[model samples]
Target chain A: MAVKAVKRIDLSLAPLVENTRRVIKGLKLHTICDSGNCPNMHECYGSSTATFMIMGNVCTRDCRFCSVKNGKPQEPDKTEPGRVAEAVVKLNLKHVVITSVTRDDQDDKGVFNFVETIREIRKRSPGTVIEVLVPDFGGIEELIETLVRARPDIIGHNLETIARLYYLLKPDSSYFRSLSVLHMVKEFNPDICTKSGIMVGLGENEDDVIEVMRDIKEIKCDIFTIGQYLRPTGEQFEVKRHVDEDEFQRYEVVAGSMKYAYVIAGTFVRSSYRAGEYYQKYQESRKG
Target chain B: MKEIILPELGEDIKEATVSFWHHKEGDEVKAEEDIVEFYTDKANFSVKAQASGILKAISVKEGEKASVGQVIGEIEER
Candidate 1:
């Protein structure tokens, strides 16, 4: 394995603002930021923005790197949709991101909740642009169609790692299945911006990353995010390598050249990081 | 006394080097106040105190690497 030289960049941390606190407390909703301990929480919340984790925090799958607890998931909260709507109205955010923990235990894999959440948010906050980061739903075509019908501004499904590390890292998820999800999203609505992301330093080679990028492009995914993977817990997988700043820049160039509409690559880049900024950029690009 | 375990930074980070500590044992800390700085593959992050208390012990030293889920220090509740 070639040792990549690491460069440490100083990140400007943002403070949590009052609007962020009100939304969390008012809705009584849990976020991946609080549950997973996202480093960008300060910056995001400080900006009065947040990615809401709907359905519930407990995931059905036991991914090694995810911090969300796993087990039998609780039943979806029927009132969560209304609460989320209320929070959006109160926060007065220009952009909204709603994600969920994978709930395979349910028949629809929590598709109904996703649909209702979008509906409610649109109803309550008509001007706020909405984005959703959803799970594969075990390749259920109906579930994908359901989310498509809801008409979110952006529909994202993370291809968490390269195919070579898929089994080792995401034993329950299928690399091909995830690709299919992204492809189907665009197939259902070509206008809807489709997005996916992958983590680096999981022992995947440059070729592996390139292959995944090609696969994503083949599916016509519009947006791509590549970030360094930090093991969520000690009991989880060990880090195979630390990708440097230069490598991230190289990946960004590769992704852009592949014709992805927008690409964000770096250590702190998450699926929802600077999501509002990107969503605006996509809209502007489409206008031209 | 409650031990403050090293937190998981993201999905793939398993171990992190202790970059610095904001307070020594016996220093009073406010609830949610940041106590230590650690470097992971992603970035250098501060571990905050979950409860208001006194720094009781430092199990991990600066520049040392700690695995996620391992206790790095202990805090005595105020």
Candidate 2:
């Protein structure tokens, strides 16, 4: 019974913006910021913010620790939702996150290119606030109710680690099919804020991280991102211990006492890192 | 010199493949160690030496591909 030594937080690196490289070269679109070597991609593209990795850049499910790129998958650029809505209207971003790569070789697994890139980034970034880090189509509740009927205010899905290292770091993923795709994304829209994330060092156990925060708060998943898994490649998956900074502030006080309306546990949290400062502090805590 | 580049390891990783080189053009390495090894589409990676000297020029070759932030080598500061 000897296991409690987590303390490693040396985060302070952020600088890289030329309008985030001119919105990925004027939306020829493709990001996970240079394919996932994301140590918060230089503090979220040095604060101009960027997270768009739309349906391409190849990946038909290989997930070891992900550095995106699987093979033979290049056909779904049907104008990549109007070139990611003209690079989210030329990077005047207010909050956007779109993600992709697990096309399982098509057949709806790409969810119609994530519902036409969230309906052309909500008709050309009008008010911009879309977020989508998806991929659980294998749990297909009609493709997670068609990306919650193309209504993306936020709908992330990443049970990245835990549940006994989900078969050694996402072995074709399925920790109860990613908690049934975040319990069917709040049974398909309960205000649509069903986020999910986890990646604490690799040898999970604090009761498997409080049973994955009680299975993502019984699948209500409002939002939660606990980072630090840093192993990006050595054949992928081997940072068996580095959960520090006071255990990410005790996992944000145990995911805010299990009532996660927002919980970004540290070590440089990712999953759209400072996602517009946590969606503006979750819209001022739901307008108080 | 500051030119270690080569990162962007995820979300549909468009190019990496190189896989092997842990230091050459004069060696030295350190800041984050593991100098070179790549292959992405979700695994097999190792580019760490963000800063800590000597390995001056490698310019993508092990099996080629590179791309992402692209530079592949050049450190020189030992």
Question: Model 2 scores what on Cα lDDT?
Answer: 0.73
User: Model 2 over residues A174-284: C-alpha lDDT tens digits?
Assistant: 889878887887887888887888877778766687777787888778777887776655667666676667777887787666666477777667767888788788678
The weakest ten consecutive residues by lDDT in model 1 chain B span: B5-14
Candidate 2 chain A has its poorest 10 consecutive residues by lDDT at A5-14
Clashing pairs in 1: A230-B12, A230-B13, A231-B12, A231-B13
> Model 2, chain B: what is the TM-score?
0.30
TM-score of chain A of 1: 0.92
Off by over 4 Å in 1: A1-19, A285-288, B1-43, B46-78
Lowest lDDT 10-residue stretch of candidate 1 chain A: A6-15
Cα lDDT tens digits for candidate 1, A1-288? 334333221122212344575568667898777677677765677677788898887889988888788888789999999898887887787888889999888999988899999999889889888899999988899899999999998999999898877788899999999999988888888988998898888788888888888888788888888987766555667778878778889988886677764778887788898998977776676566
In Å, residue A237's CA in model 1 sits off its true spot by 1.5
Chain A superposition TM-score, candidate 2: 0.31
Docking class of 2: incorrect
